[model samples]
Target: MSLIKLSNIHKRYGKGTNVFEALKGVSLDIEAGEFVALMGPSGSGKSTIANILGCLDSPSSGVYDFCGVNVSELNIKQKALLRRHYIGFIFQGFNLLPRTTALENVELPLLYRQVPKKERLRISMEALELVGLDKWCNHSSNELSGGQQQRVAIARAIASKPLFLLADEPTGNLDTKRSVEIMEILQNLNKDSKITILMVTHESDMAKYASREIVFLDGKKKSDTKEDS
Candidate 1:
């Protein structure tokens, strides 16, 4: 079964004369363990789709099914629960707390889930290790490089053992080498760990790291292609 399914999704902003449609009847499916990239120019609604998929926003109208549950019909609180348990998010900005240590930042999600402190520390450390940042766990976010900070962010996102990950322009703030390093880490997570990932990236080079690429134009899917491994 598909991990995610969106049927005839639509998103609009404003009302009456100021109405603007951001997603025009968009539909797609993401299979379990798939590494998919969403590519589009600014205003193409890629981020809107990302927001909807991450449960940050509901579609104006459409069916969004995650793991066979009708997410579109879920209330805000229910959506929050779903995101907390099943979805992880990585963003262009590291989004780490300045004064917080990498280990603490990764533990925040577990704290929200009310995981026991001992277990939280263990799992958070494990996640950091997966991202190759376990040794830097005590380092403050401000003390790390952009790549290291992003690794911490990734560790935080995965600490909850989410079913899937949503990454939005995750490499946008990094240099070419750093971007490649981040992508390599993501790719390893997807391949070795069999974690599902949906990434939004404008750079073709970045998108190339994904197994499949879906392009959007004016809020509509323009193309969907799978690359040879």
Candidate 2:
């Protein structure tokens, strides 16, 4: 079964004359182990799709199946639990707690799951090591450079061993070199761990790193192109 499936999804905000349709019967599927790049101009509804996929929002109409389960039928609390246990997120902002050690930052989510301290430490360390930040685990977020800080964020996201990752402009704040370095790490994670990745990027250069690129225009899917193997 597809890991994610959205069929004829629609999202509308406001009411009557003020109603805005953010997604117009949008349909897409993401299989396991796929790396998809979501691209679009401002107000293109890509963010709307991301929000629905992350379980932060629901479609106004149509089916959203995740792992063969209908997400549209789930309650808010259920969706929250699903997000907490199954999804990892990375953002343009590192979002690490200032003055906290990298390891501590990575431990926060594990703590929410009530994982034992020893196991949590092990998992967090492994995640950091993957991102090449294990050596800096004890350093405070303020002590790290932008790239290192984003690495910490990535470690934190992966520490739970989430089913997939959602990265929204993760390289937006970095220099070109730093951006490429981050992308390399993500590519390694996708290949080595077989983790599905959905990255939203405005830069065509960054989108090239993904296996498939899907573009949105005027609240509709404009194009979906897969890179040659």
Candidate 3:
């Protein structure tokens, strides 16, 4: 099934003399359980397209269908609710609370869902375990290394059991070896758990980790290629 569909997406900033088109009639269809990477140079609109897919922003003019519903039609509150329930986000900066323990950070999303404290703790622990960081569950964000901190961030993102995972420069801060490890974890999730993943990256090596690659340039898709399994 097509989990995400974008048609004739056009996003403009400002108007008149200062007008700029960040996305110009870009169209895409992402299937459920597919691991796709958006590859582009800086200012190529990969991040803009990622934000649109994540419901972080609405296109100026377009149809964005997510899981068969028109996401642009949703109100702010509805979009927030849907994001919490169905989307998981991982970013370049590893956005974890500095003072919070890894487990607590992972449980933060469950708190918003009003999950029971005990069950939330259980799921958070499981998520940490999935990322091979359960032993550091009590460590604060600063106490962990760059790779470990990113693992905790991944744990937290998956705690909600989201169907789609959106990552922007997920390996940006890690070394090559650590980046490979993180990519392995993501590949495992897509292979074993069937979680759909959409990631934006400038590195071709990183994009190779995905099952498919889509190149973007000048606010439009340049090509889409499916890798052989």
Indicate whether candidate 1 or candidate 2 has the larger lDDT. 1
Worst 10 residues of 2 by lDDT: 1-10
Candidate 1 lDDT for residue 16: 100
Best-fitting candidate, scored by lDDT: 1
lDDT of 1 by residue, 12-53 (tens): 999999999999999999999999999999999999999999
Tell me the tens digit of each residue's lDDT in model 2 across 121-206. Answer: 99999999999989999999999999999999999999998888999999999999999999999999898998899999999999
Q: What shift in Å separates residue 144 of candidate 1 from its native position after superposition?
A: 0.5
Model 3 Cα lDDT, one tens digit per residue, 1-229: 8999999999999999999999999999999999999998888989999999998989999999999899989999999999999999999999999999999999999999999999999999999999999999999999999999899989999999999999999999999999999999999989988999999988899899999999999999999999886
- Once fitted onto the true fold, the runs of candidate 2 whose alpha carbons sit more than 4 angstroms away are none
Counting only residues 3 or more apart in sequence or on different chains, how many pairs clash (N, Cα, C under 3 Å) in candidate 3?
0
List the pairs of residues colliding in candidate 2. Answer: none
Candidate 1 regions exceeding 4 Å error are: none
Question: What is the alpha-carbon lDDT for the whole of candidate 1?
Answer: 0.96
Model 3 CA lDDT for position 102: 97
Task: Please give the distance, in angstroms, between residue 58's alpha carbon in candidate 1 and its true position after superposition.
Answer: 0.9
